[model samples]
Target: MTRAEIFKEMEEMFGLVPSMFKSIPDATLELEWSLFKQVQLAPGEIPAKYRELMGVAISAITKCRYCAFFHTEMAKLNGATPAEIEEAVHYAKSSAGWSAYVNGMQIDFEQFKREITQVCQHVRLARESMGPGDMSE
Candidate 1:
């Protein structure tokens, strides 16, 4: 699609074409907008609410204030409660903290991967052996 076509479509969908998008080169505008619409705006395998909540967590970890605000509002638009958004950020904080600690400590990567694999296998087997009524997600 041409840049004019992409801009028209963006304005139609968003009520305005964001200035960030306008700065994209005309040659790359269509492809860039296509990817943003597909992955960020569309609800696919992951429902929109959960996906936006995940985006919030990632934005927090990456320290992107702009994306953090955008995803938090999108999460609300998609029906995430304030508590859910807070919890997602807390989880991100915990995960990021542990990652920093582990990497800083210079832990053995091979051992960590092996242990995680074993834990997953064990949990899978345990879940499979549980009775239908005893199983929970």
Candidate 2:
């Protein structure tokens, strides 16, 4: 769509076009732009590339067309190649298969809960390590 057309849509949706939306205008344009910015700039355990890949993975698994397109675009901007993005999606699918297999093999909700808890703990640790205090003094 034309830039002017996009801005017009953004105005209709957001009441005022956000700066980021100025580049791509659409409905909830401001919210979309803000989310993109947060994903890039937020302090988190995951590196930006990993976050981008994660977004792509979620998009792939959930089949969110808009999110897939937006995240793939962001992934490229963050230095992920198209191939790498594809690889991430492949891995996500593979992981899903692994999860299903494990669930079936054990048939125990407790076991699955423990596994999830461990994974969440790891994520928390990683996020903590990413904080400013963790940086070299």
Q: What value of lDDT does candidate 1 attain over all alpha carbons?
A: 0.93
Residue lDDT tens for model 2, 2-120: 55665676578659866645565455655665575466556589877878989899898888998898789878878999899999999989988898897788768887789989988
Q: Taking the tens digit of each residue's C-alpha lDDT, what string does model 1 give over 9-96?
A: 9889989999989899988888899899999997699999999999999999999999999999999999999999999999999999
lDDT scores of the candidates, listed in order: 0.93, 0.77
How many angstroms is residue 57 displaced in model 2 relative to the true structure, after the best TM-score fit?
0.5
Worst 10 residues of 2 by lDDT: 20-29
TM-score of each: 0.87, 0.50
For candidate 2, what is the lDDT? 0.77
The reply for model 2, stretches above 4 Å from the true place, is 1-36, 40-45, 104-106, 109-137
State which candidate has the highest lDDT: 1
